[model samples]
Each structure stands twice: as C-alpha cells, then as structure tokens.
Target: MQRIALLFLILGLNCIAAGAAEHSTACGSMQLAYYELGTLYYRHADGSYTGIDKDVVEEVAKRSGCKFDTVLESRVRIWTQLKNNTLDMSVSGIPTPEREKFAEFIPYFSTRNYILLHRDMPVHGLSMAGFLNDANLKVAVIKSFKHGPKFDEWLEKLWAQKRVYEASDIDSLLRLFLARRVDAIIALPTVWQPLLKKEEINKQVHLFDWAPQDSIVHGLIVSKERVSKARRDLLRKAIYSMADDGTLEQIFTRHMGSKLAQELRYDGPRF
Candidate 1:
C-alpha cells in the first residue's frame, strides 16, 4: 500500500513530449465552480479563489499539465451546473448515490466528523432520536448534504416530521443557530471554530460529540460529463499519492490543525 501510494511524478509537457500519448484528460485550461465552504474553498475580493481545495487542484493541474480557472457559487448551483455539464469540479464533496449520477468522486483524502452544537449541553445520552421526538426543537443542517449514513437516516426521519431547518451553507447554518432559530446545528470543529471566533459566538453555544466516531469522508467531486474517465482516474491516483507523501496531510493540518488531519486521514474507500 505504501509503495502504491508514494508520490509519483507530476505529469509535465516534457514527460508527454518524451513519449507520444493518446487521450487528454480535458483538464487542460478549464473553468471550475467552487462552493464557499469554509477553509476548504475560499473566495477573494478580486474574484479569485484560494484555500486547501485550490492547493490540491493546483498540484493536480501542475501534474496533469492543465490550468483551471475557478469561480465561486452556491452548493446547489454547483450541482445544477455539474448536471448541466457547465462546471468542471468541486472539493470536499461527500459522495451519495444522487450525486454520483451526475459527478464522479476521486479518492477521498479527508475524514470529517459531524457533531451537534447547542445553546447549552443537553442531558447525557441524548440521541438524535431524542431531538427528533421533540417537535419544538429544530436542527440546522446544510441543504443537499449527506451527514454520513446514520445521520442521513436520522435526518430523513426529522425531515418527515418537519423538524429540521435546512440552510444553503455553513454561514447560514451559523446564523440560524445564532438567531435561536434552531436548537442544535451540525458542525465540524475545523470549519466552525474560526467562524465562531470571527463572528464572536463561541460563548453563546456549546459543542457535543454526538458522532460515535470519525468516519465521514470527502474528496474532489468532478463532473463525469466534463471530465473523461482517464482524467478522473488520473486525479484519483494523484490524490492518493498526495496522501502517501504527507502533502495532503500537511495542507489540511496547516489550515484545519494536526488533530483533525490525523482524525481525517486517507482511510481508503468510503462506505
């Protein structure tokens, strides 16, 4: 496994010129749409993009001998564009059957744990069902996102009862929690901690380790229609190589922290 995951040469024009190749990844100089999902992807005032996702893409672009121009959009719009074959790729996408119908996921390199944060700590042993049972309580979650298998099931139950409040993104989720619109909101410490400080909401709420373990995984979600099978395969191999070389780990740990980087190690396949 270690040998297979080792850093491979980033493909360059010289490498291609050295030997004649047939199919191109179509990744050469393409436009990409990104979602403003915290540290994963950030947009700048000049309309340029930068962050962990950017780093990964740049690395891949360097290897693939491709250049990617990026634009920011809402998650829903990102999916819509992908379905319409207007977008190229995205980062930190948690795979689900519905998404796979339109896009293909590369080898996931990061693991994320979802926990419930509340205005105050609830009773010990409180479960997701406990929250669902109380009609008065509302849980805030990102729209069109799958929070692992267990929470996905629980969220379906909550949705059926109209007990869940869906938001467009994490910023909106934080707003919903701040306004006392939802009793609890699902969050990732790496994503929300900085927001809590910047927005000055740390003292206003408390976090709960509701997730049993850290298993949720994510990766670069590329559109199948826009990216060929060869390109996607190329990206998958590159991502796995990044993990093996600790480049992926360093990039994530630098922005998110070492503890989270360790917790969210590249654990092979996501089931």
Candidate 2:
C-alpha cells in the first residue's frame, strides 16, 4: 500500500510540473522582422533590435504577456520570410495591396513623404512636374516600394526616357546621390534624417519643398495564420493602452528626438 501511494504521488507531481510548463509557455514564441534602417530599426552591437518599431512592439508584447523574438534583416528578405511563415510579424511604413493578402495590418503610425537632393545641386522649385520634365535629371527609387499605380505609370514614362534608376535599397540609392550619380531620391523624411546623419551627409543633402503624393500610414503586420484572433486582439489592446498612457510618446521621443516628433506632427494613436 505504501508503494502504491508513492507511485500516485510521483504522477501527481509530474502532472503539476507539466501544467506549470504549459502555463509558462501559454503565450508561445513569435518572430518579428524590420528593416535595418536608422530610424525604423537596427541591430545593436549586442545582436538585439532597437528603434521605433522595436520599442513599440516590445512594449505591446510586455503588456500583453506575449513572448517574442526579433529578426533584423533586409526589407526584401523580411517580406519574403514573412510570406514563408518564418517571420510572425513586421512593422512596415508602406504596405502594398499585394502584401495585404498574406498579412493583416494594425494601423498605428503615419507620415508624409519627401524628396532628398544634394544641397548644392542647382535645381530649385522641385516638383513632380519639374522632375518629369527635366531630361537631364536622374532619380533613384527603391525596389518593392509602393508608390501607387499612378506613380508607377509616371515611372514607366520616365523609364522610357532613361530618367529613373531602381535601386535595391535606400543605402545604395543614397550613395548614388552622394556620389553625384543620381539627381535626387524620394523617401520619407524619417528615413532620410537617420541615414544623412550617419553618413554626415546632412550638410550635403537638402530636402526639397515638394508636396507628397500621399501620406504613408505605418502599421504592425502579422501573418494571418500564425497569430490567433485572441492574441491579435490582446496585442492591439496593449498598443492602444500604451498610446493612452503616453508610453508611445516616451519611446518615440527617446529615439527620434523631441524636435523630430514635433516636426512630424505625431499626434495620433502613438503606440
């Protein structure tokens, strides 16, 4: 009878341990990817991710009790991995309709686009019209960037004239501009600021006073298959909570600087 009691006690302890392990693992592990950019996201010397997207997502995960891992990769690879189920989610400033088929966006941040040009480049009064009309001009744009169908049509027209160069990444395009290989590049101010600062090209590049075709709305994109509705809702709620509590603003301010925050007019659902 004592031997039988010991067996039952051992079984009970095993069950308790199993239950505790399951509880600890309830949130599961997820992988999120972001571009290796200065303002958006980047890997630290310690192999950790940091930037606006990282800060916001980490805060949401902390509040929601969701365990997550981050992958710092190229934007192209991130999208490819996300499609293949290697990445659970990503934060992208521009999400195209083609990408929407595989992922759902949790709307959060938005900003207007801008053009970056060499400060001493003589062309003034920069505009879409001016760029298209100048045969001597060369413009560099990134691959997979969603500038809408209208812009694509305009680019096709420009391409016929050998005016626009499609670059693999922003860094390459920026280098082209710095080397005087291209006349200008179109990108959001947020993206330009960090890279310009990094290359000490701030004094060399000038932001033209041209109006953007559209304002970009940034969001957290999750794989539809990987995240359940309950977890998705929980994460969204946590983001909203962070916004309400000013945590989002604090994070943005820490990385982006207060002056940039004000310039961007970032008065929205912050987190």
Candidate 3:
C-alpha cells in the first residue's frame, strides 16, 4: 500500500511538471528588445509606451501566445543585448552582412534614408556618391545607427575631407539641423517624421529625395543562442501568417499613417 501511494505521488508530480512546461511554452513569455526612436518606439506622456514596432510585436505575441517584455534601450545596446543572449528578440533592425553571422532574421519592415535639411537651405538633387565625394559638405547622423559606419567608412576613403558629426539621438540631430549647425541629417523616414511632427519642425526642414543606396529592409532579429530551432520556426510561421492575414498591415497602419504604411508594404523584403 505504501509503495503504491509513493508511485502515485511521483506520477502526479511528473504530470504537473509536464503540464507547466507545455502551458508556458507559448511565446508570450519571451522578452523583446527595441530602441526608443520616434515612431519606431517611444514612451508616451502618460508613461505608457507605444510605437509601430511595439504594436506589431504585441499583435504577434497575442497570436503566438507569447508574452512580451519590452526593454527600452539605445539601438546599439539593443544589438548588444541580443548578441549577449540577454534579449530574446528585437524589431526594426537593419541587417548588415556583419550582423548576419550573429543573429537570425525575419524580414518584414521596410526603411528608407531621408536627407533632412533646413527648410531655408537651398539644396536639391543630393546623391550619396555626390555627398561623399564633396570636399565641403557637413552631414549629421545619429551615432550607432546602422548607416553611421557605412557613412564613416565612405568618408574615410575620401580622406575624411567632409565633416560628419555624430549626434547622440534623433532629437538632438533634428535640433542641430534646425539650428543650422550642420548641412544635412540622415535617418529613416519613420524615425524622422515623428520627431519633426512633435517638435513642429516640419515647416523648418525640407526632406530631400530618398537615398536608395542607404535604404534597407528592416526585420525582427532573434538571438541565435537563446532560441531553439523549433521556436525559431514557430516565430517565422507566425510572422508569415500575420503578413498573409493582414495583421501586419493593420498594425502598421494603426501606428504609422496610412500613406506611410502603404509605402512600407510596397518596399519589398529586406534580407
């Protein structure tokens, strides 16, 4: 009798453990890392956070039964966390050849580079090649953004003849542009648009033609260390399902304006 009761207790314990694992296996418990940039991500006046990336992630988590923990950090720090295995996932990251080695990607978002200039400045028909080749142009870009290094390398190859000032964040860069401290600032349209709207700087700056060379496909980046193949496959399926069912489009349109959301959808996959 005693042996039978002990066996039953052990079986019950095993069943409980198995049940817990299965219940918690949903993606809802995953922690997602993202940067605090204007439309991409930001803290609201009420202390709640909202952004296009956050909206999409939330919907994905809901559909996947994953709980998300969003960490607010700089773009570079977000990458560092993912590389170090501290973060499970991140969004709006532009994949470079160098980054592909460390992280697995799910392509979904589209991004473009815009040349932000003082509304009063007389500049038009700018090109990346022309900007880099010029000896007298001064450009301001956010430090640690994906384009920074590419721009730096290009400038160095030109013997660092042009000035490339690095601003700490988007707001500072926009302020510098408005103050006429730099000839131009470069950033994604999604990031630049919100800041311009918030600061009422739209009338103060003129957006030049898109920089196709610098534009990139943004995607969700998963840490290779923390997630198993099964989990990764699940994530990919969820993303594709969202894309097909128009969940992705709905989230994009809800957070970003309809016009911009339409553009993002048309930009094609960024791999």
lDDT tens digits, residue span 148-217, model 1 = 6677777788888888888988878888988888888776655665666664676776656666654566
Model 2: per-residue lDDT, tens digit, 1-271? 9999999999999999997776556667788776776677866789876788888887877777778787567778878877887678888545677787788777655666667776766654266677788788888889877654445566788889988888888778877888888888877656776766755777777786455545566678888878887777767778777766878767767777876654443345433
Q: lDDT for each of the candidates?
A: 0.72, 0.73, 0.72
Q: Tell me the TM-score of model 1.
A: 0.82
Q: Which pairs clash inside model 2?
A: none
User: On a 0 to 100 scale, what is the lDDT of residue 206 in model 2?
Assistant: 74
lDDT (tens digit, per residue) of candidate 3 on 12-53: 999999876775565446678778887878888999888888
In candidate 1, the residue pairs with backbone N, CA or C atoms under 3 Å apart (3 or more residues apart, or in different chains) clash, namely none
Q: Of the candidates shown, which would achieve the greatest TM-score relative to the real structure?
A: 1
Misplaced by over 4 Å in model 3 are 1-28, 123-134, 148-159, 212-215, 266-271
Worst 10 residues of 1 by lDDT: 18-27
